[model samples]
Target: MVHVVLTGFMATGKTEVGRRLARILACPFMDIDSLVEVAAGRTVAEIFANEGEPCSIPRTAAAWPRPGPSCASRPDRKRFSGGWGTPRAGRSWRTRTAHQIGLRASRRCSPSAHLRMPLPPMRSTLPSSASTTSSSACAGSWRDGDGVQVVEAEARVTAEGAVQEVEVGLGPRSYSIVIGAGLLPGVGTRLASLGLHGRAAVVTSERIGALYREPIVESLRAAGFHPTAVEFPDGEEHKNLAWLAVLYDRLLEAGLERRSLVVAVGGGVVTDLAGFAAATLLRGLPMALVPTTLVGQVDAAIGGKTGMNHVLGKNLIGAFHQPRVVIADVDVLRTLPRREFIAGLSETIKYGIIRDAALFRHLEERLSEVLELRRDLLVGLVAACCRHKATVVGDDEREEGGGRMVLNFGHTMGHALEALTDYRRFLHGEAVAIGMVAAARVSRALGRCGSETVGRLERLLKRAGLPTEIPGGMTPTALALAMQTDKKSVDGRIRFVCVEEIGRTSFVELTAQEIVNHL
Candidate 1:
């Protein structure tokens, strides 16, 4: 068992490089900073700012894991490795270059000179107590207005084509969403890189399992893991407590341990049900999501939101247990029926209206190419949406903060519509398309945004082959009744997310009557 430790200056790509190395070695990876943040419930930046450097020194040292075949990472500026133990069964693969180079810097060297060249020695004794605050070293140059410009060496190309990683900034709970083509084959390696090994439960629906189970199982086996594939009946109806019970039974029968991982591979239904199981099984197990559908990739699979629907309302029973990682492979989306694929565009369009004008325009100008699934453009589109979601999640992991509510742009009525028809009448995204248009009308009625905003949103939905109006025969009274039970309702008022204009949104608390009145 080899314990790999990655220590470097701030922003030197220690975390990213550690992930790559862990993937290659088929071992688990641990970031000390991440663990510390988790333990403290605050970011490293906040810790350093509030308590100063010495305060985090002891905390950092305490976060180090016991020696094992694991990959550990932390910035070298604090030199916490002095307290780290070596792996019991094998040698410690610790990167000593950062500290060793710091030692060789002349006492009188200027900060700029220090930045211009590497220290004379690449390997030397680690310093007992080093200070980046010293005026004589270039370490200070790395800091500009509270930001660190990391060296570009952290970026590396692999044979798997281009991959875009968007990190969700949730302090200690932060995780990465990796977007690219053919990512399924690499899922095992990535999980192993996170220091996860041993038994894993791969959960999916019957249909998706048939299409993707073999590749996922094969990849896990190659990474020296024992994987148990579990499948349940597919559909929104199955995303309920009964199926969740079935998943728990299968997982336990498979003899999964507390350290065992739960990997969700399928569309939203699978991810939601499987994710709920992972969250409750054994009190909680590590989870990784590989969302197969367009809706799952751009929306469902990103945030830590997990749940099964209740008879009363959509996602009424759920937990916010974030996954260790999300692997979205665009190639698998090709298997989706064309209608489902087009419906997925609704969420992409929502991102534009609520947060990004440029993204909205891209959808307008490249609708045809995107529908064709042009590889490069699609990858970029998925990555861009992931970034927007990451930002919102990072700012409000639990949705307790007002900032994250913007993400609920169209879900208010969308959820109600799903429950009204018993999750059979319309797909999630299709319902959201109509909900978005309805919200826009509500916004206009309230004098928050102009008619032009509503028109543009409707046009985009039409171009993408999505419905922009409530279905006929679906009475407003029934819709209002269903919405009153929605999870977003507070004190009998819906905490609705309304569009102020393109790229901005505001929350409006309204009675179910107001919602139906606008529609």
Candidate 2:
């Protein structure tokens, strides 16, 4: 329902004003900080002293909803304000659920001047059809020696049930990323809204499909689409042309047409393979992605790059096929193995360093809650990443312009490590973790960044339980050799992404010998 979120800098009397306005409106008052303190069994001061301010934000955000009608408040506006309530100078919060209704309060400038409290910003107002039975408002007020003034803002909430959408701008090939918890059951309805009907093929790995495919098939059937299940072996090793061929055979057997949709229902591997099949089968079919893993949700499935890995190098064979929609149901992450979950953080950490420095600090400060799968924090983190990726992809959908190459910050070395290990030794994320450390070293060697930058990155990776060092028995020469085949390499020179500082990166071309020398 509508939640009048009172947000501002600290000591702004948000709590005091919220309580008074709640009394005036005869509605309940909810203070996020007090809820956090009660849940933590300690005062806010003690939490900051012991656990630091970074930890407090996630805790407060996580605890905000448990005590009834809640309004999220952030003391550090610079970090939390942009993503949650208001759009910052450079960044836009485009999700349907995160829009802000700006409310302003002004006092008299003179005896003749009248106090004014304007209605919520026009952009934030809801549609006329929205019901007001469940609407709520919040106010933050203060008093001076002259007098006391109060400003209150109310929003009409829609009935979307917390589902938020981020659009990937790709002209005719664009799609929306739908994010929220408990979103799986509505997959059929969402697809129906997109005008997808007829026979649909739900492509997934046997392991993931067994757990999730039924609900998807049921949903599609209810939406007037005939659906079938196609399963393949799970894991990166199974992501090959052979499996892709099997998907084609299954689609043919099911009589799926060009208009038929392919629903990718697993993690990164499934998305890559299914998306490629959708791109190629019958010269292309519409596809939708339901990423089950953290890595898929944050990175792989959001981008339009789809491919199958070759023995020589990872993702050597692929195509650019954007999906019709990407449904990221966060609840699936609860069943993820601990190592897989931790591995996903590597990508999250990469996002922070490559573009958003504040996100990097948030990961460092709130590692525990993030690792614990706190719903609010994870949703925000995923949405932020999707936003960043959407912006980069909008500029260079095919990686033609150098704008999108910055995403390869740790990928050059990471892909080499993956190839060297035969896709068996380390997960993609773990290899990227080691690659990031190596890239940082290269940056330092080239005089781009100081040693402290490398140290901070390493420490953050370590805290995330990711490996930062190259595996034993692997030499710099061998790793450099593997880099020779990477897609980013131009001619014989490898195009490496080097970090200059947190949230800043540049691309550098180096010969194999030069890369080894840095190593």
lDDT of 2 at 495: 70
Error of 2 at 16 (Å): 9.3
Pick by lDDT: which candidate is best?
Answer: 1
lDDT of 2 by residue, 1-519 (tens): 333444433333355555543432324555666767789899766776777555665775556442123333431111111112222211122222233322233333211123243322222212321222132333324434433444423322211133456789998888999887788999999999999899999999988988999999999999899999999998898899888888889889999998999999999999999999999999999999999998999999987889889888989899998999999988899988899989989999999999999999998899998888866567778888888988999999998887898888888888988888789989889999998898899899999899989999999999989999987898878977888888777889977788889999887889867977887
Candidate 2's TM-score? 0.73
**lDDT of candidate 1 over 1-519, digit per residue (tens):** 223344434434455544543443233556778878899999877886787665666677566554333323432112221211112211122332222212122223323343553333222212433332121112222334423332222112111234667898877778999988888988889999999999998999889999999999999989988999999987899999888888889999999999999999998998888888888888999999999999999999988899888899999999988999999998888899899999999999999999999899989998998998866567778888999999888888888877888888888888888898899989999999988999999999999999999999999999999998888898989999998998878899988888998999988889998889987
TM-score of every model versus the real structure:
0.70, 0.73
Of the candidates shown, which would achieve the greatest TM-score relative to the real structure? 2
- How many backbone overlaps does candidate 2 show? 0
Clashing pairs in 2: none
